[model samples]
Target: MAPAGLLDAFWGYERALMANDLVALDGFFAPGPQTLRADAGGILVGHDAISAFRRGRGGAPARTIGDVHVRRITDDTAVVIAQTLPSTGGRGQQTQVWCRTTDGSWVIEAAHVSQPAAAIAAAVWRVVGSPLVAGAASGPLVGQTVAVKDLFAVAGFATGAGVPAFLAARAPAGDNATVVAELLAAGASVQGIAQTDEFAYSIAGRNAHYGTPPNGAVPGAIPGGSSSGPASAVALGQASIGLGTDTGGSIRVPASYQGLWGLRTTHGAVSRAGMLPLAPSFDTVGWLTRDAATLELAASVSVDAAAQRSLEPSFVVDPSLVALATPEVQAAFASAVAGLSVTSVDLGDPDELVEAFRVTQAAEAWMSDGAWVDAHPGALGSDIAARFAVAKGITEGQALAGASAFDGARAHLDRVLGDRILLLPSASSAAPSTTAEGAELEAIRGSTLRLTCIAGITGRPALSVPLMTVPVETTAAAPVGLCLVGPRYSDLALIALGAALMAPLVE
Candidate 1:
C-alpha cells in the first residue's frame, strides 16, 4: 500500500535529481537518519549531516528516471523508489531512493547508480542469518519476534535438519545461536524455531521435519526454500524477520518468491558456531525483510559483528551477461543495475564454476548425512536419497582435489577483488509455481540454483538484493524478485548498496 499524497512531492525530488542539486536532496531527509556503509564506518547518524555529505557528491542528472513508486510505511513516512539517470553527463542508467517528509518534500535516502544493462538487483538476503554479534544499542531491535531456522541452535529446540529422526535423536540444545543471543540481548523475543527443507536442501519450502508453511505471497505456488518456513512466516506478516541459511539459492529463492529482501554474507565473515551444517564451506546465515532499510538494519547488526567492521565499497559486473533469467526477470534486473554506481568486470563462463560446485556439494552432503542415512534410512526425502547417491561416487581424491580447486578459486577471486563486492544472479528465475510433488518440480529446482551455486562452492560472501519485481503476466500473483551477489565479507558493502537503491529496486 502506498502512502496518500506520496506523488505530491515526487516531482520535487525529480527536479533535484535532474538538476543534480545535492542541497535539495539533503533537505529531504529526516533528522537523525541512519546511513550504513562498509569501509566508510557503516552507520551515519544525523540525517541533516548525511544529506550534506550526499549533496557533496554532486552527482549528475540520471539518464532515465522511472515513474515514482511509493509504499506506505507510516503516517508520515512513505518509502519511495524510482529508476533514473545517475549522473548529469551520463546516459540513462541509475536508481534512486527517497523518503517523504512532512512538508511534502522527498529526500534521498540512498542511491545505487549503475549502467542500465549491467544489472540492478539492488540487494537480496534471506529469512535471517549468521550468529548475531554483540551490539551497543539500548535494545533497538527489542520487542520484535524473530522466527529461527532449524539449523540455528536454540537451547530447547532440537536442530532438525528437516529430518524427523534427527529431531528425535538430538536432545534439545543448551544454548542459542549467536544471532538469537544477540537479538535477545537487544531485547527481542525469540519465537520458536521455524521449519526449513531437509537440511536446507530444496527450494520448494516443503519440510520433512516440519510441514510446509503456507505461501502467503503465492498461495498455491511453492514458498521457495530452503529457508522455507522463515519466509513463509514473514510473508504472512507473523514475524519481523525470519532467520535463515543460504548455501546456494536457498535463502534468495524464498525471499524473492515471497517478495522480501534476503542477504547472504561473505562466508567466514559471519560465525557459524551453532547452526546445522549443509556445506560448511558455502553455507551462510541470512535474514528476510519486506523492504530494503529493514534489510540494511539487520545487516548493520551482523556486518562486522555489530558495527565493528567496515570497508571501502567497490563493485563488480560480470562481462558475460548471459540470459540467466526469463525475459521479464532480466528486464527487471537490468532496470535495477541502471540505478546504481557500478563498474564492470569479466567473470568468464560460469558453467565450470557452477558444475564443480554441484560435485563438491554432493560430496559434502554425503559426508555430513550419508552416515546419518545409514543409521536412519527411513527418515529421508527422495531428493536426499538422490543427493546421497551422487555423493557416493565422489572419490576422496576428487573431494580433496575439488576442495583445493575451490580454495584456489576463492583465493583468486580475493586477489582480484582486494575486498570489493561481486554482483551475480540470485537465481535463474523467481518463485517457481510448482510443488515438491509436481511433475516439473525437480527440473525447476535444479534450474533455479544454476546461477547461485557459485557462491556456495567458494565459501564467498554473497547477498541477494530484491531490486525489481516482474509481475507474472500469466497469473494474478503480482511480482517476483531481482537479486544481487557480493564477495566474501562484503555483507556491509552489500547492505550499503542495497540501502542506496532499495526504493527503486522493489518498485
Candidate 2:
C-alpha cells in the first residue's frame, strides 16, 4: 500500500489541475529545473516552464479519474499510474514519479501523458483520408504526403475557403489545381484539404467558424495563417508538404511562427489556375515543409528552371526593415546576420508601401468575393467582416491611387534587389499569445505586414528559414524565421542557400 499521505497528495494535485489552481498546482510540483511534464505536444522542463504553460493553457479539460494504481518504491518515493476518462470520451493515461520532500509532502518529479489518437483534427483539416488522393508510382517526392490548403481545387471536393456557407454553395471541383496536379504527379499523395482563413484574406490563423488550429511550435500561440491549416498539419507531422499560397504573408508568417521552411515562389512563377485568389496582384503559390530538402524537392517539380535566374551568393540587409521586428527578433536577426556577408541598404518607408499594398489587396479582395459575401449576410467572422467592410468602402479612385503607388514601389524594390538576396526577419515577433486581441493584436499584425509587404510589393521569391527563436510564455522558446528575399525565379536557389545555412546548425 502507498504511504499514509501519498494518495491524499495525489488527489489534491488532481483537484488543483481540474480547478486550474495555479498556486496550489505549483506547490504540488517540486521546485527545480529537473521537474518535467510531457505530452503529445512536447516536453516541458523545469518548474518555471511547467508553471508558465499551465498559466497560459486556460485550463485542463474536464475529466474524471478512472483507475488508480500505486507502487511504493521506498518510504519517501513512489510511482503512480492513473487512467483518465475525459468528458469528451477519450481514454488517457498519466504516469508520475512522486517523492516525499524534506517537508514530508509528496511532489511530482516527472510525468508523462498519453492520449488516444485522433482520426482527424477538425480545426486543422476539413476533410482527410488514409490518402485522399494517391500520387504517382515514383518520383523525388515519392512517399511524401501533402496538405492541400482549402483554397486549392482538390478534385471531388469543394474548396471551402474556411467558410461554411461558401462551401455549402459550391460544387465539387472537377479537377485539381495546377499545383495540386503537379504535386500528385511528383509522387506526393494528397493528405486532405486543410483549413484556411476565410477567403484567404487574413494572415492571422484563427478561423472563427471552425476554431483555431493548434500551433505545433508554441503551445498556446496562434498558428499564423491564411495557410494556418497546412502549416499546422506539417508541424504536427500529419503531412510532409504544405501546399499553400502567400498573398501577403500567409505562408511565411505561419512558417516562421511554426518553425517550418516556407517558400513563396515569384509572382506568376507557379500557375494560380484552379486556385482561389485573395489578391491576384499578390497571390503566389508556395510550399511549407519541416526541412529544406523537402521544400526544394517539392519546388523542383513545379518551378521552371529556364525561368529561374542565377544570382551571386551575396546578401543585403535593410536596417529600416530589420527595425520592424520585436527586440528579441531583432537581436536574433543581428546575431544571425553577424556571421553572414551582407551589405546595409535603405529600403525606404515601409508604412507607405504597407498601406498601398493593403489598399490594393482590399480592393482586389472585394472584387473577388464581395458578391458572395453580399449574397450571404453575416457569413464571416468579426475580424474579416470588419476588413471587408473597409474594403467595401474603398473608392475606385483610392484603389487606382494605391495601385499606382504599389507599382512604383515594386519597381523600386526590384531595381534595388537586383541579383542580391535581402535578409530580414520573417515576422515581427514570435507567434502572439492566443489571448492577445484588440489594439495589441493589430499592432503585431501591422509590424509583420510592414516586413511581409516588401516581398509582396516586389513580387519576389521570399523564403522563410526557421533559423531563429524568441522566448515565449507558453514554451521555452518560440521560433522566428530568417526571411530571404531573392530576385524573381530564384525559388530553387533560395532553398539551396537556406539549406546550406541550416546545415551547420543541424550538425
Candidate 3:
C-alpha cells in the first residue's frame, strides 16, 4: 500500500490540476533533466520543457480523477496511477513517479498522460478570437507576436472583461483599440485575447468566470493582475508582446509577479480610446515584454514620443517605502540598487497615499461599473462584490475630497522628485499564495496596493524591473520587482533605465 503522505500529495495535485493553477502544477514536478512528463502530444525531457508545455497549453480541461492507486517503491519514491474523466468528454490515464525532494516536498520524477486525442486552444489565451489588421504591417514592432487583454477592443471580437455576463451583454468591438491599431500598423500580429480580473478590478489575478492565469516566472505563485493574462503570455514566450491596461497597479504588479518587463505608462501618455474603462480617471494602456529592446520597441510604437523628457539618472531612495517589503525582498531591492549613487528622500505616510488612492479609484470605478452591477445583481464574484459595496458607500462629498487629495499628493510627489527618479518596491512582497483567502488575502492585497498606489495617484510612469528574487515557501527564490517612478511623460526613459539595470539579464 502507498504511504498516507503519498495519498495526500496526490489529492493536492489533483486539486491544483483542476483549478488550472499552473504555478502549483509546476511545483509537483521535480527539477532536473531526469525528470520528465510524456503525453499524447510528445515527451517533455526536462523541467524546462514540461514547464513550457504547461505555460503554452491554455490549460487542461476541468476533470475528475478516481480509482487512484499508489505503490510504495521505497521511503523516498512511490508510483501513482489514476483515471481522469474530463468534463468535456473522454477518459484518460495518468501515471506518476513521485519522489521526495531534499526540502521534503513531493514532486513527480516521471509521468505519462494518455487521453483521447482532440483539439484544444493554447492555455495562455482565454479567447483565441479572429485577428484584426490595420492596413499593411510596417513598423518597429514587425515580426512580433502580440496578445491583448480581453478588456481592450479588438474590432470584430467580443470584449469579455473576464466576465461571461459582460461578454453576453456587450456587442462585438467596432474598432480596434488605439494601441492595437498602432501595434498592427507597426508590423505585430495579434495572437488572442487574454483573461483579466472581473471588470479589471482586482490585482489578485483571479477571475470569476474564466479562471486565473498562471504566473510563468514563479510556478505555484499568483500571477498579479488585473493584467494577469497579458503578463502570463509574455512570461511564457507564448506572445512576444502583451498589451494591457493599468489602472492602479495592474500592469506593474503583474510584471513584478511574472518577472517580465512591465510598464505603467504616464497618464494620458497613450490614448485610452477603444478600450473598456475600469476607472477612466486613472486608466492608461501599457504592455509587457521579455527583454529591454522589445520593451523599447513596443513603447516606441505606443507612447507619444513628443511627451518624453530627458532626465538625469540620479536616484532617490525612500526608506519608508522600501521597508514595506519582506526582509528577503528588501535585501534583493538593496542589492539591485546598490551600484547606483542613491539619495535618501521621504514621501510621507504610504497609508495616507493609499487611502487617497482608494477613495478616488473607488469613486471612478463605481462611476464606470455601478450600472452594470445594478443591472446584473449577483453577476460579480464575492470579493469584487464586496469591493463594489465599499464603493457604493462612499459619499459624494468624500469622493470629491478624495479626488482633491489625490491631486495634491501627485503635486507633492512631482515637487519632491523633480527631474530625479523615485525608487521603491514594485510590490510589497512576492506574489501571494493562491491558497491565501479571506482576511489573509485582503491583507496581502491591501499591503501591495499601498506600495503601488503611489504611481497610480501621481499619473507618473513606473517600470517594474525584475532584477531581484525573494524566497517563498515552496520555491527557493521567486522574482520581485524594483520600481522606478519618473515624472510624467518619462515612460520611455523609465524603460531605458530598467533595461540598463537589468542589462546582465537581457544581454
Best by TM-score: 2
Ordering by lDDT: 2, 3, 1
User: Cα miss at 38, model 3 (Å)?
Assistant: 11
In terms of lDDT, the best-performing candidate is 2
Comparing candidate 2 with candidate 3, which one achieves the higher TM-score? Answer: 2
Ten-residue segment with the worst summed lDDT in candidate 3? 128-137
Candidate 2, poorest ten consecutive residues by summed lDDT: 433-442
Query: Cα lDDT for residue 356, model 2?
Result: 85
Each model's number of backbone clashes? 62, 1, 6
2 versus 3: better lDDT goes to: 2
lDDT per residue (tens digit) for residues 174-207 in model 1: 8888876766766656655677788776777765
Per residue, candidate 2 scores C-alpha lDDT tens digits across 326-433 of 899999999887888899888789888899899999999999999888888899999999989999999989999999999989888878878889999999999987
- For each candidate in turn, the TM-score is 0.67, 0.95, 0.82
Ranking by TM-score: 2, 3, 1
Per-residue CA lDDT of candidate 3, range 1-507, in tens? 776477788888888887778889888888876777876433566786577667645677788886788888988899999998888788888999998877777889999988865432333476653343433456777778888898888888889888788788788888898888888888888878887888999888887676667678765567889988888878877788889988888988898888888888988989888888978778988988888789889889878788788778989998988887778888988888888899998887989898889999999889998888888888999999999989989999999899899889988877888878988888888887666666876887787888888788888888988888887644556788889988889888888888778787657
Model 3 misplaced regions, further than 4 Å: 1-124, 129-135, 505-507
